[model samples]
Target: MSRPRRFLPSVSLLTAFEAVLRTGSTAAAARELDLTQGAVSRLVQNLESQLGQPLFLRERRRLIPTEAARAYGRDISRALDLVARASMELAANPGGGVLSLAILPAFGTRWLAPRLAGFLSAHPGITINLATRLKRFNFAAEGFDAAIHFGVDDWRGAGHLRLFDETLVACAAPAFLRANPIRQPADVHALPLLQIETRPTAWPEWFRAHGLVAPLPRGMLFDQFAPMTQAAIHGLGVALLPEFLAMPDLDEGRLQRLPGAPVSGTGSYWLVWPEARADYPPVVALRDWLAAETADLRAREGAGDGADDGDRTRTP
Candidate 1:
Protein backbone atom coordinates (compact mmCIF):
# COMPACT_ATOMS: atom_id res chain seq x y z
CA MET A 1 0.00 0.00 0.00
CA SER A 2 2.89 2.42 0.46
CA ARG A 3 6.22 2.66 -1.38
CA PRO A 4 9.09 1.59 0.88
CA ARG A 5 11.68 4.32 1.68
CA ARG A 6 15.19 3.83 0.27
CA PHE A 7 17.65 2.88 2.98
CA LEU A 8 19.74 5.88 4.13
CA PRO A 9 23.50 5.63 3.53
CA SER A 10 25.80 4.77 6.45
CA VAL A 11 27.41 7.52 8.52
CA SER A 12 30.69 6.66 6.84
CA LEU A 13 29.18 7.15 3.38
CA LEU A 14 27.49 10.41 4.42
CA THR A 15 30.76 11.63 5.95
CA ALA A 16 32.67 10.80 2.78
CA PHE A 17 30.18 12.62 0.53
CA GLU A 18 30.19 15.55 2.93
CA ALA A 19 33.95 15.75 2.98
CA VAL A 20 34.19 15.69 -0.82
CA LEU A 21 31.49 18.36 -1.19
CA ARG A 22 33.17 20.55 1.43
CA THR A 23 36.76 19.99 0.36
CA GLY A 24 35.99 20.10 -3.41
CA SER A 25 37.85 16.90 -4.36
CA THR A 26 38.03 13.22 -3.47
CA ALA A 27 41.77 13.45 -2.83
CA ALA A 28 41.20 16.33 -0.42
CA ALA A 29 38.40 14.39 1.31
CA ALA A 30 40.71 11.34 1.53
CA ARG A 31 43.34 13.52 3.20
CA GLU A 32 40.77 14.81 5.74
CA LEU A 33 39.30 11.34 6.49
CA ASP A 34 42.60 9.49 6.13
CA LEU A 35 41.05 7.29 3.44
CA THR A 36 42.19 6.40 -0.06
CA GLN A 37 40.67 8.43 -2.97
CA GLY A 38 39.16 5.26 -4.45
CA ALA A 39 37.61 4.52 -1.08
CA VAL A 40 36.05 7.99 -0.88
CA SER A 41 34.75 7.81 -4.47
CA ARG A 42 33.15 4.44 -3.76
CA LEU A 43 31.38 5.94 -0.74
CA VAL A 44 29.91 8.83 -2.84
CA GLN A 45 28.85 6.41 -5.58
CA ASN A 46 27.18 4.21 -2.98
CA LEU A 47 25.32 7.23 -1.56
CA GLU A 48 24.20 8.20 -5.10
CA SER A 49 22.89 4.72 -5.77
CA GLN A 50 20.87 4.73 -2.52
CA LEU A 51 19.17 7.99 -3.52
CA GLY A 52 19.14 7.06 -7.25
CA GLN A 53 20.37 10.56 -8.15
CA PRO A 54 23.69 11.56 -9.65
CA LEU A 55 25.43 13.99 -7.24
CA PHE A 56 28.53 14.67 -9.34
CA LEU A 57 29.63 14.81 -12.99
CA ARG A 58 33.10 14.11 -14.41
CA GLU A 59 35.11 17.30 -14.93
CA ARG A 60 38.58 16.47 -16.33
CA ARG A 61 39.60 13.57 -14.03
CA ARG A 62 37.83 14.90 -10.90
CA LEU A 63 34.09 14.61 -10.14
CA ILE A 64 32.20 17.91 -9.70
CA PRO A 65 28.79 18.21 -8.02
CA THR A 66 25.74 19.33 -10.00
CA GLU A 67 23.40 22.14 -8.80
CA ALA A 68 21.26 19.46 -7.14
CA ALA A 69 24.37 18.20 -5.41
CA ARG A 70 25.11 21.72 -4.18
CA ALA A 71 21.68 21.88 -2.50
CA TYR A 72 22.13 18.47 -0.90
CA GLY A 73 25.60 19.42 0.22
CA ARG A 74 24.30 22.38 2.20
CA ASP A 75 21.74 20.31 4.12
CA ILE A 76 24.16 17.44 4.75
CA SER A 77 26.87 19.84 5.85
CA ARG A 78 24.60 21.42 8.44
CA ALA A 79 23.42 18.05 9.75
CA LEU A 80 26.97 16.76 10.05
CA ASP A 81 27.94 19.94 11.90
CA LEU A 82 25.15 19.46 14.44
CA VAL A 83 26.18 15.86 14.94
CA ALA A 84 29.84 16.80 15.32
CA ARG A 85 29.00 19.47 17.88
CA ALA A 86 26.90 17.04 19.91
CA SER A 87 29.67 14.48 19.79
CA MET A 88 32.23 17.00 20.99
CA GLU A 89 29.92 18.16 23.75
CA LEU A 90 29.52 14.61 25.03
CA ALA A 91 33.32 14.25 25.02
CA ALA A 92 34.35 17.66 26.40
CA ASN A 93 34.25 19.61 29.67
CA PRO A 94 33.55 23.37 29.84
CA GLY A 95 34.52 24.33 33.37
CA GLY A 96 38.26 23.80 33.07
CA GLY A 97 39.17 26.37 30.43
CA VAL A 98 40.44 29.95 30.66
CA LEU A 99 37.97 32.80 30.20
CA SER A 100 39.55 35.49 28.04
CA LEU A 101 38.29 39.04 28.42
CA ALA A 102 39.14 42.45 26.99
CA ILE A 103 38.69 45.47 29.22
CA LEU A 104 39.51 49.15 29.40
CA PRO A 105 42.68 49.56 31.43
CA ALA A 106 41.28 51.99 34.00
CA PHE A 107 37.95 50.19 34.55
CA GLY A 108 39.77 46.90 34.95
CA THR A 109 42.29 48.20 37.46
CA ARG A 110 40.14 50.66 39.40
CA TRP A 111 36.87 48.74 39.51
CA LEU A 112 36.89 45.16 38.21
CA ALA A 113 40.36 43.72 38.85
CA PRO A 114 40.14 44.53 42.55
CA ARG A 115 37.09 42.25 42.87
CA LEU A 116 37.78 39.42 40.36
CA ALA A 117 40.10 37.40 42.63
CA GLY A 118 37.02 36.30 44.57
CA PHE A 119 35.54 34.85 41.39
CA LEU A 120 38.80 33.03 40.65
CA SER A 121 38.87 31.74 44.21
CA ALA A 122 35.34 30.39 43.99
CA HIS A 123 36.01 28.62 40.70
CA PRO A 124 39.45 27.25 41.15
CA GLY A 125 39.11 25.14 38.03
CA ILE A 126 38.65 28.29 35.95
CA THR A 127 40.97 31.23 35.25
CA ILE A 128 40.54 34.58 33.53
CA ASN A 129 42.87 36.11 30.94
CA LEU A 130 42.49 39.88 30.85
CA ALA A 131 43.85 42.22 28.18
CA THR A 132 43.37 45.94 27.78
CA ARG A 133 41.62 47.75 24.95
CA LEU A 134 41.96 51.47 25.58
CA LYS A 135 39.09 51.98 23.19
CA ARG A 136 35.80 50.10 22.61
CA PHE A 137 35.62 47.02 20.29
CA ASN A 138 34.02 43.81 19.07
CA PHE A 139 34.65 40.82 21.36
CA ALA A 140 34.31 38.03 18.81
CA ALA A 141 37.20 38.77 16.44
CA GLU A 142 39.44 39.55 19.39
CA GLY A 143 38.95 35.92 20.53
CA PHE A 144 37.78 37.13 23.89
CA ASP A 145 35.19 35.24 25.90
CA ALA A 146 33.86 38.63 26.95
CA ALA A 147 34.78 42.31 27.24
CA ILE A 148 34.00 45.30 29.48
CA HIS A 149 33.77 48.48 27.41
CA PHE A 150 32.34 52.00 27.61
CA GLY A 151 29.56 53.53 25.43
CA VAL A 152 25.79 53.13 25.23
CA ASP A 153 24.53 50.32 22.91
CA ASP A 154 26.98 51.33 20.18
CA TRP A 155 28.82 48.09 19.51
CA ARG A 156 27.41 45.79 16.87
CA GLY A 157 27.60 41.98 16.29
CA ALA A 158 26.99 40.77 19.84
CA GLY A 159 24.79 40.42 22.89
CA HIS A 160 25.13 43.49 25.09
CA LEU A 161 24.76 42.66 28.76
CA ARG A 162 24.84 46.00 30.49
CA LEU A 163 27.12 45.95 33.54
CA PHE A 164 26.44 49.43 34.84
CA ASP A 165 24.88 52.74 33.86
CA GLU A 166 27.65 55.02 35.06
CA THR A 167 27.17 58.63 36.14
CA LEU A 168 30.01 60.95 35.10
CA VAL A 169 31.27 63.70 37.40
CA ALA A 170 33.81 66.51 37.61
CA CYS A 171 36.28 66.36 40.46
CA ALA A 172 39.50 67.96 41.74
CA ALA A 173 41.64 68.10 44.89
CA PRO A 174 40.38 70.03 47.96
CA ALA A 175 43.03 72.71 47.83
CA PHE A 176 42.16 73.61 44.23
CA LEU A 177 38.48 74.26 45.08
CA ARG A 178 39.36 76.19 48.27
CA ALA A 179 41.57 78.51 46.31
CA ASN A 180 39.15 78.92 43.33
CA PRO A 181 35.45 79.39 44.02
CA ILE A 182 33.10 77.82 41.41
CA ARG A 183 29.61 79.30 41.76
CA GLN A 184 28.26 78.90 38.23
CA PRO A 185 29.08 77.08 34.96
CA ALA A 186 30.56 80.32 33.60
CA ASP A 187 33.30 80.12 36.25
CA VAL A 188 34.52 76.78 34.82
CA HIS A 189 35.89 78.53 31.70
CA ALA A 190 38.30 80.65 33.76
CA LEU A 191 39.77 77.61 35.61
CA PRO A 192 41.97 74.81 34.25
CA LEU A 193 40.04 71.95 32.56
CA LEU A 194 41.08 68.28 32.43
CA GLN A 195 39.94 66.33 29.37
CA ILE A 196 39.72 62.59 28.77
CA GLU A 197 40.94 61.55 25.31
CA THR A 198 37.99 59.23 24.88
CA ARG A 199 35.19 61.61 25.74
CA PRO A 200 36.15 64.94 24.30
CA THR A 201 32.65 66.30 24.84
CA ALA A 202 32.35 65.31 28.51
CA TRP A 203 32.72 68.80 29.93
CA PRO A 204 30.44 70.27 27.29
CA GLU A 205 27.84 67.61 28.10
CA TRP A 206 28.02 68.51 31.79
CA PHE A 207 27.56 72.13 30.88
CA ARG A 208 24.65 71.16 28.60
CA ALA A 209 23.09 69.15 31.46
CA HIS A 210 23.18 72.30 33.58
CA GLY A 211 22.02 74.45 30.57
CA LEU A 212 25.46 75.78 29.60
CA VAL A 213 26.94 76.16 26.09
CA ALA A 214 28.91 73.65 23.98
CA PRO A 215 32.45 72.69 22.75
CA LEU A 216 34.60 74.01 25.63
CA PRO A 217 38.16 72.69 25.32
CA ARG A 218 40.66 74.64 27.43
CA GLY A 219 42.52 71.77 29.13
CA MET A 220 44.92 68.87 28.65
CA LEU A 221 43.75 65.48 27.31
CA PHE A 222 45.08 62.13 28.49
CA ASP A 223 44.72 58.78 26.67
CA GLN A 224 43.52 56.94 29.78
CA PHE A 225 41.11 57.58 32.67
CA ALA A 226 43.45 56.70 35.57
CA PRO A 227 46.03 59.18 34.34
CA MET A 228 43.38 61.83 33.75
CA THR A 229 42.14 61.31 37.31
CA GLN A 230 45.71 61.31 38.56
CA ALA A 231 46.31 64.67 36.90
CA ALA A 232 43.14 65.85 38.65
CA ILE A 233 44.37 64.40 41.96
CA HIS A 234 47.49 66.49 41.62
CA GLY A 235 45.24 69.58 41.11
CA LEU A 236 46.23 70.17 37.48
CA GLY A 237 42.60 70.91 36.57
CA VAL A 238 38.99 69.73 36.92
CA ALA A 239 38.59 66.21 35.52
CA LEU A 240 35.34 64.88 34.09
CA LEU A 241 35.29 61.21 35.10
CA PRO A 242 32.70 58.49 35.48
CA GLU A 243 31.73 58.41 39.16
CA PHE A 244 31.88 54.66 39.70
CA LEU A 245 35.34 54.48 38.13
CA ALA A 246 36.55 57.31 40.36
CA MET A 247 35.20 55.97 43.68
CA PRO A 248 38.61 55.03 45.09
CA ASP A 249 40.01 58.54 44.72
CA LEU A 250 36.76 60.02 46.01
CA ASP A 251 36.97 57.70 49.06
CA GLU A 252 40.60 58.49 49.68
CA GLY A 253 39.91 62.27 49.61
CA ARG A 254 42.48 62.50 46.85
CA LEU A 255 39.87 64.39 44.83
CA GLN A 256 36.87 66.60 45.71
CA ARG A 257 34.35 68.64 43.70
CA LEU A 258 33.39 72.30 43.20
CA PRO A 259 29.96 71.81 44.82
CA GLY A 260 26.31 70.93 44.04
CA ALA A 261 26.76 69.11 40.71
CA PRO A 262 27.66 65.58 39.58
CA VAL A 263 26.45 64.27 36.21
CA SER A 264 25.06 60.75 35.99
CA GLY A 265 26.81 58.51 33.43
CA THR A 266 25.09 58.93 30.08
CA GLY A 267 26.91 55.85 28.84
CA SER A 268 27.04 52.28 30.11
CA TYR A 269 29.58 49.54 30.66
CA TRP A 270 28.45 46.36 28.88
CA LEU A 271 29.68 42.76 28.63
CA VAL A 272 29.72 41.79 24.97
CA TRP A 273 29.94 38.37 23.34
CA PRO A 274 29.12 36.85 19.99
CA GLU A 275 25.68 35.20 19.87
CA ALA A 276 27.28 31.95 18.73
CA ARG A 277 28.95 31.80 22.14
CA ALA A 278 25.83 32.56 24.19
CA ASP A 279 25.87 29.17 25.88
CA TYR A 280 29.55 28.75 26.83
CA PRO A 281 29.94 28.24 30.58
CA PRO A 282 32.57 30.80 31.47
CA VAL A 283 30.86 33.50 29.42
CA VAL A 284 27.43 32.97 30.97
CA ALA A 285 28.89 32.82 34.49
CA LEU A 286 30.93 35.99 34.09
CA ARG A 287 28.01 37.89 32.60
CA ASP A 288 25.81 36.99 35.56
CA TRP A 289 28.51 37.79 38.09
CA LEU A 290 29.32 41.18 36.60
CA ALA A 291 25.64 42.11 36.38
CA ALA A 292 25.06 41.26 40.03
CA GLU A 293 28.16 43.09 41.16
CA THR A 294 27.20 46.27 39.29
CA ALA A 295 23.66 46.18 40.71
CA ASP A 296 25.05 45.90 44.23
CA LEU A 297 27.39 48.80 43.62
CA ARG A 298 24.54 50.94 42.29
CA ALA A 299 22.37 50.10 45.29
CA ARG A 300 25.15 51.10 47.66
CA GLU A 301 25.66 54.31 45.72
CA GLY A 302 21.94 55.18 45.90
CA ALA A 303 21.89 54.55 49.66
CA GLY A 304 24.78 56.95 50.06
CA ASP A 305 22.10 59.56 49.16
CA GLY A 306 24.11 62.50 47.86
CA ALA A 307 25.94 62.46 51.20
CA ASP A 308 29.32 62.50 49.52
CA ASP A 309 28.81 65.21 46.97
CA GLY A 310 32.51 65.86 47.50
CA ASP A 311 33.03 64.48 43.95
CA ARG A 312 31.18 67.49 42.53
CA THR A 313 32.97 69.87 40.15
CA ARG A 314 36.03 71.57 41.66
CA THR A 315 37.80 74.72 40.47
CA PRO A 316 41.11 74.47 38.63
Candidate 2:
Protein backbone atom coordinates (compact mmCIF):
# COMPACT_ATOMS: atom_id res chain seq x y z
CA MET A 1 0.00 0.00 0.00
CA SER A 2 3.06 2.27 0.15
CA ARG A 3 4.52 4.14 -2.81
CA PRO A 4 7.69 2.64 -4.37
CA ARG A 5 9.65 5.90 -4.00
CA ARG A 6 8.95 5.91 -0.23
CA PHE A 7 11.89 3.47 0.08
CA LEU A 8 14.33 6.13 -1.25
CA PRO A 9 15.82 3.73 -3.88
CA SER A 10 16.58 5.03 -7.36
CA VAL A 11 14.94 3.40 -10.41
CA SER A 12 18.49 2.66 -11.65
CA LEU A 13 19.08 0.59 -8.51
CA LEU A 14 16.00 -1.53 -9.13
CA THR A 15 16.85 -1.82 -12.81
CA ALA A 16 20.35 -3.06 -11.99
CA PHE A 17 18.97 -5.50 -9.44
CA GLU A 18 16.45 -6.88 -11.95
CA ALA A 19 19.04 -7.14 -14.71
CA VAL A 20 21.62 -8.89 -12.58
CA LEU A 21 18.99 -11.26 -11.22
CA ARG A 22 17.85 -12.14 -14.73
CA THR A 23 21.27 -12.38 -16.38
CA GLY A 24 22.82 -14.08 -13.32
CA SER A 25 25.97 -11.96 -13.55
CA THR A 26 26.89 -8.32 -13.13
CA ALA A 27 29.02 -8.45 -16.30
CA ALA A 28 26.07 -9.77 -18.34
CA ALA A 29 23.75 -7.15 -16.86
CA ALA A 30 26.32 -4.43 -17.64
CA ARG A 31 26.55 -5.62 -21.26
CA GLU A 32 22.75 -5.55 -21.59
CA LEU A 33 22.45 -2.07 -20.01
CA ASP A 34 25.60 -0.66 -21.67
CA LEU A 35 27.09 0.05 -18.26
CA THR A 36 30.35 -1.02 -16.66
CA GLN A 37 30.31 -4.15 -14.50
CA GLY A 38 31.46 -2.14 -11.48
CA ALA A 39 28.68 0.41 -11.94
CA VAL A 40 26.06 -2.32 -12.22
CA SER A 41 27.37 -4.02 -9.12
CA ARG A 42 27.38 -0.68 -7.27
CA LEU A 43 23.75 -0.08 -8.27
CA VAL A 44 22.79 -3.49 -6.94
CA GLN A 45 24.65 -2.76 -3.69
CA ASN A 46 22.89 0.59 -3.35
CA LEU A 47 19.51 -1.10 -3.76
CA GLU A 48 20.38 -3.77 -1.17
CA SER A 49 21.48 -1.06 1.26
CA GLN A 50 18.29 0.96 0.63
CA LEU A 51 16.16 -2.12 1.31
CA GLY A 52 18.37 -3.12 4.31
CA GLN A 53 18.55 -6.74 3.04
CA PRO A 54 21.09 -9.10 1.55
CA LEU A 55 20.05 -9.62 -2.10
CA PHE A 56 22.71 -12.09 -3.19
CA LEU A 57 25.01 -14.76 -1.74
CA ARG A 58 28.60 -14.50 -2.91
CA GLU A 59 30.53 -17.77 -3.20
CA ARG A 60 34.16 -16.94 -4.07
CA ARG A 61 33.75 -15.69 -7.69
CA ARG A 62 30.04 -16.55 -8.16
CA LEU A 63 27.05 -14.43 -7.09
CA ILE A 64 23.74 -16.19 -6.52
CA PRO A 65 20.52 -14.19 -6.01
CA THR A 66 18.74 -14.75 -2.74
CA GLU A 67 15.02 -15.62 -2.69
CA ALA A 68 14.22 -12.00 -1.89
CA ALA A 69 16.11 -10.78 -4.94
CA ARG A 70 14.29 -13.24 -7.23
CA ALA A 71 10.92 -12.14 -5.83
CA TYR A 72 11.78 -8.48 -6.32
CA GLY A 73 12.93 -9.15 -9.89
CA ARG A 74 9.64 -10.89 -10.72
CA ASP A 75 7.61 -7.96 -9.41
CA ILE A 76 9.68 -5.30 -11.17
CA SER A 77 9.83 -7.14 -14.52
CA ARG A 78 6.18 -6.39 -15.27
CA ALA A 79 6.57 -2.80 -14.10
CA LEU A 80 9.63 -2.44 -16.35
CA ASP A 81 7.66 -3.82 -19.32
CA LEU A 82 4.94 -1.25 -18.67
CA VAL A 83 7.51 1.53 -18.51
CA ALA A 84 9.21 0.36 -21.73
CA ARG A 85 5.92 0.18 -23.65
CA ALA A 86 4.83 3.58 -22.40
CA SER A 87 8.18 5.07 -23.39
CA MET A 88 7.97 3.44 -26.84
CA GLU A 89 4.50 4.85 -27.43
CA LEU A 90 5.56 8.30 -26.31
CA ALA A 91 8.62 8.17 -28.57
CA ALA A 92 6.60 6.89 -31.54
CA ASN A 93 4.07 9.74 -31.32
CA PRO A 94 5.81 12.72 -29.74
CA GLY A 95 2.97 15.13 -30.47
CA GLY A 96 0.14 13.03 -29.01
CA GLY A 97 -0.66 9.51 -27.76
CA VAL A 98 -1.21 6.08 -29.26
CA LEU A 99 -4.28 3.93 -28.70
CA SER A 100 -3.06 0.34 -28.88
CA LEU A 101 -6.02 -1.96 -29.34
CA ALA A 102 -6.64 -5.70 -29.40
CA ILE A 103 -9.33 -6.63 -31.90
CA LEU A 104 -11.13 -9.71 -33.11
CA PRO A 105 -9.81 -10.85 -36.51
CA ALA A 106 -12.92 -11.17 -38.66
CA PHE A 107 -14.73 -8.23 -37.09
CA GLY A 108 -11.66 -6.04 -37.45
CA THR A 109 -11.11 -6.91 -41.12
CA ARG A 110 -14.67 -7.05 -42.41
CA TRP A 111 -16.40 -4.51 -40.16
CA LEU A 112 -13.97 -2.22 -38.39
CA ALA A 113 -11.29 -1.93 -41.09
CA PRO A 114 -13.75 -0.64 -43.68
CA ARG A 115 -15.23 1.88 -41.21
CA LEU A 116 -11.94 2.96 -39.56
CA ALA A 117 -11.17 5.73 -42.04
CA GLY A 118 -13.83 7.92 -40.45
CA PHE A 119 -12.27 7.57 -37.00
CA LEU A 120 -8.79 8.36 -38.33
CA SER A 121 -10.14 11.38 -40.14
CA ALA A 122 -11.92 12.57 -37.02
CA HIS A 123 -8.96 12.07 -34.64
CA PRO A 124 -5.90 13.30 -36.46
CA GLY A 125 -3.78 13.60 -33.34
CA ILE A 126 -4.16 10.08 -31.98
CA THR A 127 -2.42 7.11 -33.59
CA ILE A 128 -4.49 3.95 -33.56
CA ASN A 129 -2.62 0.62 -33.59
CA LEU A 130 -4.57 -2.59 -33.93
CA ALA A 131 -3.56 -6.22 -33.33
CA THR A 132 -5.73 -9.30 -33.76
CA ARG A 133 -6.55 -11.17 -30.57
CA LEU A 134 -8.26 -14.53 -30.69
CA LYS A 135 -9.00 -14.68 -26.97
CA ARG A 136 -9.42 -12.43 -23.94
CA PHE A 137 -6.20 -10.87 -22.58
CA ASN A 138 -5.14 -8.69 -19.68
CA PHE A 139 -5.12 -5.10 -20.83
CA ALA A 140 -2.58 -4.01 -18.25
CA ALA A 141 -0.14 -6.81 -19.05
CA GLU A 142 -0.77 -6.72 -22.81
CA GLY A 143 -0.51 -2.91 -23.04
CA PHE A 144 -3.83 -2.48 -24.83
CA ASP A 145 -5.91 0.66 -24.39
CA ALA A 146 -9.08 -1.24 -25.22
CA ALA A 147 -10.37 -4.29 -27.04
CA ILE A 148 -13.23 -5.20 -29.36
CA HIS A 149 -14.69 -8.05 -27.36
CA PHE A 150 -17.43 -10.32 -28.69
CA GLY A 151 -19.36 -11.89 -25.88
CA VAL A 152 -21.74 -11.15 -23.05
CA ASP A 153 -20.84 -8.21 -20.78
CA ASP A 154 -18.65 -10.44 -18.62
CA TRP A 155 -15.09 -9.26 -19.27
CA ARG A 156 -13.65 -9.30 -15.77
CA GLY A 157 -12.18 -6.07 -14.34
CA ALA A 158 -13.21 -4.06 -17.39
CA GLY A 159 -15.74 -1.46 -18.48
CA HIS A 160 -18.12 -2.60 -21.18
CA LEU A 161 -19.83 -0.55 -23.88
CA ARG A 162 -22.32 -2.63 -25.81
CA LEU A 163 -21.75 -2.49 -29.58
CA PHE A 164 -24.30 -4.82 -31.17
CA ASP A 165 -25.61 -8.36 -31.13
CA GLU A 166 -24.41 -10.74 -33.84
CA THR A 167 -26.71 -12.34 -36.44
CA LEU A 168 -25.74 -15.67 -38.03
CA VAL A 169 -26.99 -17.33 -41.21
CA ALA A 170 -26.35 -20.72 -42.77
CA CYS A 171 -24.72 -20.33 -46.16
CA ALA A 172 -22.18 -21.91 -48.49
CA ALA A 173 -20.86 -21.62 -52.06
CA PRO A 174 -23.78 -21.82 -54.48
CA ALA A 175 -22.17 -24.75 -56.23
CA PHE A 176 -21.94 -26.79 -53.01
CA LEU A 177 -25.53 -26.03 -51.98
CA ARG A 178 -26.76 -26.85 -55.48
CA ALA A 179 -24.90 -30.14 -55.52
CA ASN A 180 -26.30 -31.12 -52.09
CA PRO A 181 -29.73 -29.53 -51.96
CA ILE A 182 -31.15 -28.81 -48.51
CA ARG A 183 -34.94 -29.14 -48.28
CA GLN A 184 -35.22 -29.10 -44.47
CA PRO A 185 -33.21 -28.05 -41.41
CA ALA A 186 -32.38 -31.73 -40.81
CA ASP A 187 -30.63 -31.78 -44.15
CA VAL A 188 -27.78 -29.72 -42.58
CA HIS A 189 -26.81 -32.71 -40.44
CA ALA A 190 -25.92 -34.69 -43.53
CA LEU A 191 -23.83 -31.92 -45.13
CA PRO A 192 -20.22 -31.24 -44.23
CA LEU A 193 -20.85 -28.88 -41.31
CA LEU A 194 -18.04 -26.38 -41.05
CA GLN A 195 -17.63 -25.37 -37.43
CA ILE A 196 -16.35 -22.25 -35.73
CA GLU A 197 -14.04 -23.42 -32.96
CA THR A 198 -15.07 -20.80 -30.44
CA ARG A 199 -18.80 -21.39 -30.96
CA PRO A 200 -18.81 -25.17 -30.82
CA THR A 201 -22.51 -25.40 -30.10
CA ALA A 202 -23.67 -22.84 -32.67
CA TRP A 203 -24.79 -25.39 -35.27
CA PRO A 204 -26.65 -27.53 -32.74
CA GLU A 205 -28.23 -24.49 -31.12
CA TRP A 206 -29.35 -23.15 -34.48
CA PHE A 207 -30.89 -26.52 -35.31
CA ARG A 208 -32.63 -26.69 -31.92
CA ALA A 209 -34.04 -23.21 -32.48
CA HIS A 210 -35.44 -24.43 -35.79
CA GLY A 211 -37.29 -27.28 -34.00
CA LEU A 212 -34.94 -29.92 -35.34
CA VAL A 213 -33.01 -31.96 -32.79
CA ALA A 214 -30.02 -34.07 -33.77
CA PRO A 215 -26.38 -34.83 -32.88
CA LEU A 216 -23.98 -32.07 -33.79
CA PRO A 217 -22.42 -32.90 -37.14
CA ARG A 218 -18.64 -32.97 -36.94
CA GLY A 219 -16.63 -31.46 -39.82
CA MET A 220 -13.74 -29.16 -40.64
CA LEU A 221 -12.91 -26.76 -37.78
CA PHE A 222 -11.94 -23.12 -38.28
CA ASP A 223 -10.66 -20.79 -35.62
CA GLN A 224 -11.87 -17.59 -37.23
CA PHE A 225 -14.70 -16.44 -39.52
CA ALA A 226 -12.43 -15.20 -42.30
CA PRO A 227 -11.02 -18.60 -43.14
CA MET A 228 -14.25 -20.43 -42.38
CA THR A 229 -16.07 -18.17 -44.82
CA GLN A 230 -13.28 -18.67 -47.37
CA ALA A 231 -13.50 -22.42 -46.92
CA ALA A 232 -17.23 -22.22 -47.56
CA ILE A 233 -16.66 -20.10 -50.66
CA HIS A 234 -14.26 -22.75 -51.96
CA GLY A 235 -17.13 -25.23 -51.58
CA LEU A 236 -15.51 -27.04 -48.64
CA GLY A 237 -18.90 -27.40 -46.92
CA VAL A 238 -21.88 -25.60 -45.42
CA ALA A 239 -20.75 -22.81 -43.12
CA LEU A 240 -22.79 -21.01 -40.49
CA LEU A 241 -21.57 -17.51 -41.28
CA PRO A 242 -22.42 -14.05 -40.08
CA GLU A 243 -24.73 -12.33 -42.55
CA PHE A 244 -22.55 -9.24 -42.90
CA LEU A 245 -19.56 -11.35 -43.94
CA ALA A 246 -21.66 -13.46 -46.29
CA MET A 247 -23.48 -10.46 -47.81
CA PRO A 248 -20.74 -9.51 -50.32
CA ASP A 249 -20.45 -13.09 -51.52
CA LEU A 250 -24.21 -13.65 -51.60
CA ASP A 251 -24.84 -10.42 -53.50
CA GLU A 252 -22.05 -11.31 -55.97
CA GLY A 253 -23.50 -14.83 -56.35
CA ARG A 254 -20.43 -16.44 -54.81
CA LEU A 255 -22.27 -17.87 -51.79
CA GLN A 256 -25.93 -18.79 -51.19
CA ARG A 257 -27.93 -18.86 -47.97
CA LEU A 258 -29.58 -22.10 -46.89
CA PRO A 259 -33.32 -22.38 -46.15
CA GLY A 260 -33.32 -21.61 -42.40
CA ALA A 261 -34.22 -18.17 -41.05
CA PRO A 262 -31.56 -15.84 -39.68
CA VAL A 263 -30.55 -16.91 -36.18
CA SER A 264 -29.84 -14.35 -33.42
CA GLY A 265 -26.57 -15.18 -31.68
CA THR A 266 -26.29 -15.60 -27.92
CA GLY A 267 -23.62 -12.97 -27.44
CA SER A 268 -23.08 -9.30 -28.34
CA TYR A 269 -19.98 -7.47 -29.42
CA TRP A 270 -18.68 -4.89 -26.95
CA LEU A 271 -15.98 -2.26 -26.61
CA VAL A 272 -14.18 -3.19 -23.42
CA TRP A 273 -11.33 -1.49 -21.62
CA PRO A 274 -9.79 -1.41 -18.19
CA GLU A 275 -12.36 0.17 -15.84
CA ALA A 276 -9.54 2.33 -14.42
CA ARG A 277 -9.02 3.86 -17.89
CA ALA A 278 -12.65 4.78 -18.45
CA ASP A 279 -11.68 8.46 -18.58
CA TYR A 280 -8.63 8.09 -20.86
CA PRO A 281 -9.03 10.43 -23.85
CA PRO A 282 -8.04 8.08 -26.66
CA VAL A 283 -10.23 5.31 -25.29
CA VAL A 284 -13.16 7.68 -24.97
CA ALA A 285 -12.73 8.77 -28.59
CA LEU A 286 -12.70 5.18 -29.91
CA ARG A 287 -15.66 4.16 -27.76
CA ASP A 288 -17.71 7.16 -28.91
CA TRP A 289 -16.87 6.49 -32.58
CA LEU A 290 -17.80 2.82 -32.29
CA ALA A 291 -21.07 3.73 -30.54
CA ALA A 292 -22.01 5.97 -33.46
CA GLU A 293 -20.92 3.38 -36.02
CA THR A 294 -22.98 0.53 -34.56
CA ALA A 295 -25.92 2.88 -34.14
CA ASP A 296 -25.77 3.74 -37.82
CA LEU A 297 -25.55 0.05 -38.69
CA ARG A 298 -28.62 -0.79 -36.57
CA ALA A 299 -30.50 2.16 -38.00
CA ARG A 300 -29.72 1.07 -41.56
CA GLU A 301 -30.73 -2.49 -40.76
CA GLY A 302 -33.97 -1.20 -39.22
CA ALA A 303 -34.63 0.87 -42.34
CA GLY A 304 -34.57 -2.39 -44.34
CA ASP A 305 -31.14 -2.00 -45.84
CA GLY A 306 -31.69 -5.35 -47.46
CA ALA A 307 -28.71 -5.24 -49.82
CA ASP A 308 -26.12 -6.16 -47.17
CA ASP A 309 -26.33 -8.40 -44.15
CA GLY A 310 -26.86 -6.33 -41.00
CA ASP A 311 -23.37 -6.01 -39.23
CA ARG A 312 -21.84 -9.50 -39.17
CA THR A 313 -18.84 -9.09 -36.87
CA ARG A 314 -17.52 -11.90 -34.67
CA THR A 315 -14.57 -12.41 -32.33
CA PRO A 316 -12.40 -15.51 -32.65
In candidate 2, where is summed lDDT lowest over 10 consecutive residues? 307-316
Q: How does candidate 1 score on lDDT? A: 0.75
Each candidate's TM vs. the true structure?
0.62, 0.88
- Model 2: per-residue Cα lDDT at residue 212: 87
Model 1 over residues 201-239: C-alpha lDDT tens digits?
Answer: 678778888887754577788888888888888888888
Q: What is the Cα-based lDDT of residue 88 in candidate 1?
A: 57
Give the per-residue lDDT of model 2 (tens digit) for 1-316.
5687747577788788888888989999999999999999889888888888899999986789888778877878888888888899889887757898899998888888998999989988889999999999877778788999887767787877777777889998988988998887888888888988888778877888899885656779989998898999999998888777788888999898898798877677888888767778898889888878877656644634332222222332
* Leading candidate by lDDT: 2
Off by over 4 Å in 2: 1-4, 298-316
- Provide the RMSD of all predictions against the true structure, rounded to 1 decimal: 10.1, 5.1
lDDT measured at residue 229 in model 1 versus the true structure, 0 to 100: 85
Best by TM-score: 2
Local error of candidate 1 at residue 290 (angstroms):
1.3
Error of 2 at 170 (Å): 0.7
